[model samples]
Target: MDDCTDRATKRSFLAGLGSLGFIAFGTAAGRTSAATDSQNTDPQPGKGPFTDSDEPEAFVDDVMAERIGTTTPGATVAIVSGDTPSLTKGYGAADVDADVPVRADETVFRGGSVGKLVTFTAVMQGVEQGVLDLDTDVNSYLGDSTVTVPDTYDDPVTLRHLGTHTAGFESTLDPDIVADPAALDSLEALLTNQQPSRIRPPGELVGYSNYGAGLAGHVIAEAHDTTFEEYVQSEIFEPLGMTRSTFAQPVPDDQPGNLAAPHVRDGESFLVADDVYINMRPAGSLSATATDMAAFMSAHLGGGAVGDTRILDAETAETIHSRHHVRHPAVTNWRYGFHEYGNPDANLLGHSGATVKFTSYLLLALDHDIGIFVAYNGNPSEGPKAVVDEIVAEFDLQQAPTTPTPTWRSGGQERAETVAGEYSLTHLPQSGPLQVVDLLEHLTVEPADNGRLRTTILEGDGRQWVETVRVRGGGRARCPGLRGYRWRGGRAEYE
Candidate 1:
């Protein structure tokens, strides 16, 4: 990866604190983060046949600059292809108070829910080795006669449900773990005390549950007769050659030097959060560098093989990316560990992670064998999805045939300002909030580049309520009500 200091001029964008602030925190089960040496190094170009050239670098620079100005004290981004990383850049200070700058390969941040992917991989390995079965009831492996499912759940919760978060288990870890770093050390006792619920029948619907993942990790530990941390280290990390990755509590002690401090917006400034540990290691407690994560992404993209090492068979890897169940029928595409973007014409699969202060995303183009990993040190007004969409567009890395870019007429700033407002989901009320949505009409907007007259809906509710609606073409905006509902897409709808 190239370490570049050629900074780009900052761009003015939306700003805020907490959920209103640019923090990216997903509630999924696993988490990961880190920092490294800084030396002036040339940007290493992508290994894939297609290269993004200067466009991607410029785009990345703009992103980092925005985060530095808005949320994080420092930020590190690593973009890689196949076996080699293309870009690794750092911006701002790693320690704001100490004024320590972030290094491309050195700075580490929380992994957030990305660690769940690793846990999922570990479970799959056990399944492949005949040590576990995906279809087998999880209670069989738990071997606890005292533990029983609620009578409400007619179907038994299996390993598959647990792995895919369909087991209906709910996480009960103390929320104060963010404030108390040592809380995670007593995870087993906590899990034992707080019996999770089977709110829904197993495999009935996809409801993300950290408890489900932690339970799966627990089951793996029991089946292998070892601590979950040790089992993951021995079976997954070591084999994958992730030298610096670990599930250690009180992070820096486990893997020193390369740790990225967590950041939270304090007033108009960004400050580091107290070092927090997760007792639910399986769901969100792994720390790794961008390079190490790139290796993991490469393995997944390469069908479970990083170079000559085959961590999983091609078939098993394929299973990991495939959609295990429909999460929300109206919510477009939601899959097992990842979500699908685009329709039958084009699709990309990946998952995004966020902690209190950091936002990260990993996207893979399965057909093209291309993948991208992005991690930011601080929060941004825009989420990581914006970064992913921009990179893919700037690089022309879509799996399907390319479509012609549409021409957009710039509507005056007044129109842009008029359309930009927070919108709530009436149908899916629980999906959180959306904010700063800019709507455009009859514009062939490319990814990464913002357009004018674009009526964008900043969903007050974070749920992606509008699916299958054309954002560019002139159609009725089918968005949920509460608006100057200008003509952009089709008429907006509630459900």
Candidate 2:
């Protein structure tokens, strides 16, 4: 049960998997024919669609071992582009004590909140079928009147709000719910019973709520006259050809050969999850391989058409990526389920998922017909962000910089007066200004190695708020907390 022994067992298991299947859909003739059909069309330059090269799998192994050597017993990773370009790889162990080796396509890691996208898709399908309206009051679909809505809200709670995390419902996955297994028996019970706190009124602000999405799932189940699990399986999973995906609690023991054991950090040790079944099933319960998830993303990147199957219309898929509502005053670019970046040139949309031991991220560029999906079966500290950043850079997938100025500030003396001022964070639209609460009297603005102004905010009481301000396009400075602020127009009001 020691950490080292546990890790070794997991590594051995992941390394012992047998041969894996790789499928190639289009033939040379088919590719040629498709290219010929689009001869008159000019395709834009894209970063990838990258095929896995024979770079020593050593690089990936080093990454996995170094990052999660202490916490995760084993791990796996799979990346895919369009139908033709793909890379499926695995490393580490499925279970440390069991000595199960992780297989690329075979290992089934918890999808976590990635399952929300599945539920979101199902809700959208209900919208398309007229069984559910995005803007309709959810009370109609609920069989019971246990859940209550605030009277101050003029607008009704719609399926759209649930998908976009704007339902204004408080999250019920608190300590009590986590402690009790049966607390998740019904969504209405969880919602109506949980105290109501009006967070910016429904649809006005976007705050992530597992309670809101699970409520939507319950509504969908009632509307279709079937269990939420069954409805999603038949309508979404089966149609998208995700044979391995499911919402079942604890996943079926006899179902698949590649089930990834969940892990958690216990002080200096990483142990298996104690309570795997919590109330966030609708928000985070899902399991699948990269191959299956790629199909889901393929359908999205392919304009809602994966091979011969079309689960959603192109327009509807586009709308899902569109900004429905803003989430936070500080993070204005976040909308609904997707995070919006203000750079007009880089129109990317996607969601990041984190569970007890896994972190997954999926991003797609509608204009470029490009998509990327990443899944890691370890803690977020296992370097998922670095891997994602590298992928984005490698593919050159990001939009062009809006501002042309180099990140470095030119030769200049540290000027406290020049930089000191009240600035508005304007990257994301806001109702009011973001005042710099304290600008140190003896503060200085200096150029960091990266072309940006580093302002040292010092207080007479010895407190400090150091901020790095990067110039984003249109004479706007990108400040971390304050977002994009006007650089020149606003005058400094000294305290």
Candidate 3:
């Protein structure tokens, strides 16, 4: 584990998040304490979780149409298994102001962080072509002249490190991300101009780094001598026939009316998110139809090919799916661009993404031969809680262990003050001078009884204390009282 010499820094950061009216955690709490505490009633545990025994008829549809719609204005879902897609459906209004309903086949929504999966797929394909090496120092490619990583030591960041999120880059969140299309910067220029700090030694810790993914995209662009979007379009999307999918900003000229407008809930209206351009298109902002995403899911599961259009060699595909670095052995690990969470063998792989208004989730249950994609055009606290996790539970992908309160001798927190500190998400970018958010986002830990520690999170209105019921290894705190978010090395490792 890394040194805990920065405990006061950690506490100040988390305490800051709690002080910010607890806005982040409030975004995902969902329903009430009574509802979340209910036992699992899925009889098959294999077929579905929200079955008739647990809820009303057409439980999945009910959630998409009613529960999710209560917050998000529009959403689309696609479920594919084996050779065919079992479901491709949409719910609620695409444009509440225009009275247009969402359609799974026609409307497109931002895929958010799921786009990283597509980006890494291309990176792996390039590796197969012998154009790049996963273990080579990435700076050697981007060049010490253009982008320099200070204090890299013996082991510099590599493509594999970037894919597994162990590259040790601190987060960088540019508040001006939401800008006009013309105002956005090129991937290379952005990487060179606003390079992130290497907070940890390479391959030392698994902190989700979007900056690393974006940097990888830039490296790919440099190698191909083309824009990141163009490389992905010509190599991956076109081959898979994801015609409506795009990484380009400004929605492109050809796909104007097709892309769904961003929206958020108002009392009775859906507020249209302003036409703000996203700068980190490589990190997120991939727009595609649910039907198109299914094709992607199909290709990855089909040994990196859809029909005969081979995207990556079968061997390369196998390599990407294999575990590269495992943070937890029994639980799961990171496989190239993907990380395992819910499955036992860690066969299932995917990502979840979000912006101010848009949220998306993608899961590939390879063993089950099923791929699921869900995206909503509005920001809702329960967007993922009710949509993704519930659905994953239904498929019974893997038997993930839950941290229940142990009755044994029990571990206690003797080094509470030592462990108490703030952790900023490695996935997000840490603004250089704009320290407000970084301060507010800090997660503070304090000692508590029963081996528990009081932690603060940003959610809903503001900051509040969330006590952890159990403390795990590597200075990690498991809040069984909450959603079982495990924090180690001053960062949230997994949920």
Candidate 4:
């Protein structure tokens, strides 16, 4: 309900773009809980709160209602319990100037980086058909294409690396956004011209890369000898019967769904604004309704199948959900295209997304067979992820009771001192004008009392960490307030 930033006219589009990069990295799925018993337990038909219930829908309704006009001009939400679509609803005004209300099945909202899931799903499809291999060098697929990965290191960039965000593409923080739709170029041209240098070896570290995702889509298209949009439309969306989803810019007016008008906050109200086109379409240019997204989630929860149609085999879907990259043993890691939601052990997977004026988030509780998707027409500090966090907590999805047990391990203070320093996220830009954002995102670690460590960001949001054990590179620590919230010592290194 609080204003995220100044409502100045100057802070409308570009200001939101500045935070888009960070929003992609936001983990609003659940609290870091150390509870082990229920984290891995699968939900039975009548054994849990989420499956076959109206409680989750009611909770989501309340959450969306509170955030509708204040946090975002309009929002749509979808929840899938087991194999059934439990809830699909909309809130607030879709086009404020026209006084149009959102309709979950008819109103389309830009999905931003959340579309990376669809792109990666296509990659998994290629893998299933034996047209592509995860570990195979990506250059092999671009045999006649204009884009090619430069051999910057001994290792070749592979589809696995791209899906896991370990392809090592240099960070630019911008997804080739253009004001005019006419300025958008072909996927191959965009990839070739804006190719980022590989700064790290493939599969080395988990640095988020929009280029990596875009290139994955291009590879899929080339392998199928078709365009990205066409392939997904015919292969993924069509098979799943998702008619309201498309990766096309401007969302073709003839399409059945009504595209939600973008909005900018203006002194407790919102004004309609123009939408920008993402040149790297596969990475962030999906426009879908909540109803269509429900089908997408149902397919994933059903192990790549929905009813009689199966886009991916059960084995392929399992592989996509399996861990593809590990940031640390204690913290969240990357699944094929999705990332670990809360506790790595919790088995929750999700992704957050943002465009200049829209924000969205998706989470799948594999253990509970529940999928939650939310999208907003306006990008605020508290966006769709905030709604996701509330739903996650209300349902006790990935969280556990916090009961602190102090450790008496030797050299605790010394280990804490070793991690004490100022650091920045690897995903943030290290070069270009966007590098300025890295300055503000620095996480400062300082040794606290009783061998605990304190982490404070430039925004002064401080979290306490208690050391549990020494790991390979450094030590592992968890927060006592929320048990099981652990992270590797060098989560952020000195900049």
Candidate 5:
């Protein structure tokens, strides 16, 4: 209990980093009155009060109203429930300097890593077309390109590994953002020059890599004999009528609608910041509007079709939402191109994204047939994710966190002692200037009374955990919401 409390404290501190500012708006009275009244009158004991079919505009308005103009200059939001857009709205300013108000239908915000969903969608389309295989060596499709995945380990890197971020590529934490759009190289050139060395065996670990994402996009392009942008533009954006979305960096001057200017906090005000270009377009270059995103989300929620325009068949869409990689049983894990949001037990698939100055988050509640997307013009320590978290919590889109029952094993103390130690996340950069992030974020585990273990980070409060044997020779240690344990070289690592 002490450990869970401390970890919550740590999470609070981390979430504060991207906190957004907002301007209050007139409440949409009676918008959700039906749902609110029912929820208040007949509350369920263990479920979210609101239903998936409830009108969410009022709730979303309240969430955004609290943070406009304080952290981000402007923001866009989209919510789709049961194959229809319930709300698509914009608030504050897209360019505070020019005093341009964001229009949910007209203003474009960078989707950041949220765009990876589109890239991965294209990959699935190829799979449906029999042009791509998730388990095949990625090199098989890269024969026309200069890039190649070296035989760094016994198992060759596969599309599945890349999609799951388990390709073992060292984390560079960069998608090659450049100051000048002119400096941006072709997708092929950027991937060839900036490829990171594979540091572990394929599928052995989950190391989030921009390189891996870019590689996946390059593979799709190679397989289809098309540029990454061109492939998605035809298969995804055009089919779904996402006219305001594009992976072209600088967002094509001729593209319709205005681009939302990125912002930075300036005391109590905000200053319009320069927008950078993504060299690896496939990884994080997508710029889109809330309205366009709503359509995209609806397509997924509607089983890969938005009003009869099908980008993927039902089976392909389901496979895309299925779990592809798991780092732990209790916490968030990867699902194809998307990662699990909040509770792993919850049937929610999501991904968070950011450029240097913009941030965005997208989530799909598969069971509920609902999808939420939010993006901000300014990258704060806490941004769109906070809004998504609040929506999920309010709607009961997923199971809330709960205390885990301890396995009353006979020899917990012995196992606890065997696994207690300071360890770093293997997915973090192992070598480079960014390696210090691993050092600062490393975990320190200490045995506690009654065979429970206490774990602390370099700076956060200690968390309590219990041990259970998950495999014949491996150990499983879990906290309230986090769980995973692996033993290698006589060392203990937790995820």
Candidate 6:
């Protein structure tokens, strides 16, 4: 809590926007490790002290195999201990048509906005070197004088605000696949022409914004007098030896060989989607391998450097993770680009990535010196989330937030009344054919029996997460057995 930025609310809203984690996944529910154990015994090469068993990797191996069975095809995973990747492997085919199997070391998957970690690291480096100021208006470094912001709030959006997703910009891009490179627009052009409206004041509300993050990347690029792609390549990727990664859309000419083709599930199988390009590559559209991401993850795990190649100094790394905003204590909050993910009891930070077809997840148990990453080429009915959850459960969480949950009728009901309403966020499509999704943005919370409240928080996209939530203090409610998520009135909030 070192001068922790803004406080309170849910990190899940960001995840709802396709970014954010903690106490990680909910309980395994009907899925059990005991059942998975009997299904597959694919063992790894090493063991760790996470569990009391002699074969610690056994649980993870079993879990991976079982979970992959539920997916269409192709997932690469990596788990690191300290600066070393203790577990790294692949499952199924990279291209079912080509019959090419996925290789953990070579196949690439879109990192999505998790690439914003690289973007934020670059911005923070700018702050460290006095090239930029975190608290100053971003328009100053934007290099375009005519670009104007909607006069929605008195405060201007700043670098720190973008890092924690409090820039208040509405969604300007759609989840529709940008399959043609010719359709791409420059970052500034995208910002200028399709400029999103600033719906709230800066640094006040926490809404996961791809536009805000992409703008931060643009600011860093302008500060360095370079393109965002060039700046990251020379500063972050090369330093960390993440050679198999690229922000360039249309899969750079020399690297398309390594790119994993996007796939979608039709009933019980994965069908390859056409190659895609994203106009807002800064927000999403990063193609990388799990092995490459592990190197990036290892750099953070080892305090911003790995073997003399330093992307960020120790202090810069810590400052980057410093909390910038929280809407409720019940849900997780942003610490710069990462989230206070996993069990609140355990010191963890991570992000999740999902494109139209591909999905990825990253986790760093900082205190335990562990980093885990999983990326898949296809969207599955079950999703790859269960895999990450099982991995998170391996860590020893020390009874997160030991305070007993205050039961209903004991002053919690009064708090529920004040919070019941229709809350909305800005993650919806602003002006696309998909803008109809804006209807999905509004969440209605009403008091249920026994002092609990109910709402359809996030039920679409293979999720039924928000059904019932227990009222907590501060106009917030915690959905029992769910990850930290609370709602009220804020940027990504309900009224």
lDDT of 1 by residue, 1-495 (tens): 100110110011211212111233421111112233322222444535344445445677766555464544665666655655556666676766566777766666667667777888888888878899988777788675334445566678887777665575532322123457644545455556656655445665444566676777888887898888899888778887777788767665656446776666666666666655666677676777766777788888788898888888988888777767653322234455565654323457766555556666677777656676666665555656567777777666665433333334343233334334433221111222321222211112111223232222332212111112223334322221112132213432111
The better candidate by lDDT, 1 or 2, is 1
What would the C-alpha RMSD of candidate 6 be, to one decimal place?
7.1
| Residue runs of model 2 more than 4 Å from their true location after superposition | 1-71, 143-145, 171-184, 265-275, 326-336, 341-344, 380-383, 400-495
lDDT (Cα, tens digit) per residue for candidate 5, span 1-495? 653312352333223322111111111110110001111111222333344434476687778777776656678888776456777788778887787888888999998888888888888988999999999999999986899888988899999998988898887776887898789898888888888998778887676777888999999889988899988998888878889899997788799988988877766677777778888887888999998998999998888887768888999999999988875555567788998766677789887777878888899998877788999887776678889989888887876567545677677777677667766666566678867766677677777888878867776667676644342355544443344445545554444
* lDDT of candidates 1 onward, in order: 0.56, 0.52, 0.64, 0.75, 0.74, 0.64
lDDT of 3: 0.64
Report residue 346 deviation for candidate 4 (angstroms): 2.1
Model 5: residues with Cα > 4 Å off, grouped in runs = 2-54, 468-494
Candidate 6 error regions (>4 Å): 1-57, 144-151, 173-177, 397-403, 407-415, 429-435, 448-492
lDDT of 5: 0.74
Stretch of 10 with least lDDT, candidate 2: 28-37
Residue 46, model 4, lDDT? 55
Total backbone clashes of model 3?
Answer: 32
**Per-residue accuracy of model 2 over 1-495 as CA lDDT, tens digit each:** 111001121111111110000000110000000000000111222343333342213344445555443535555554445543244555555555465666656777766566777788778777778888888888777755566566557777777777776665543322112434554555556556654454345665444566676777787778888877888889877887777777766566775647776655555544555444545456666787766676777777776778788888877777776767643222334433555432434676666565545656666655656555556555534334455555556556675443232223642223222344543211111221211211212223334432334443343221222233444444434333323222333432110
By TM-score, the best candidate is 5
Give lDDT tens digits, candidate 4, residues 203-276.
Answer: 77766788898899999889999999999999988877789899988678788888999888766577788878
Ranking by TM-score: 5, 4, 6, 3, 1, 2
The segments of candidate 3 whose C-alpha lies over 4 angstroms from its true place after superposition are 1-57, 143-145, 174-176, 330-332, 343-346, 400-495
Candidate 4: stretches off by over 4 Å: 1-47, 50-53, 401-406, 448-450, 458-464, 471-495
Which should have the higher lDDT, number 2 or number 3? 3
Candidate 6 C-alpha lDDT tens digits along 334-431: 78888777555466787777776677788887777778788767654344555777776655522344334334346555655555666564445445
- In the order shown, what is each candidate's alpha-carbon RMSD? 10.9, 13.1, 8.0, 8.0, 6.2, 7.1
- What is the alpha-carbon lDDT for the whole of candidate 4? 0.75
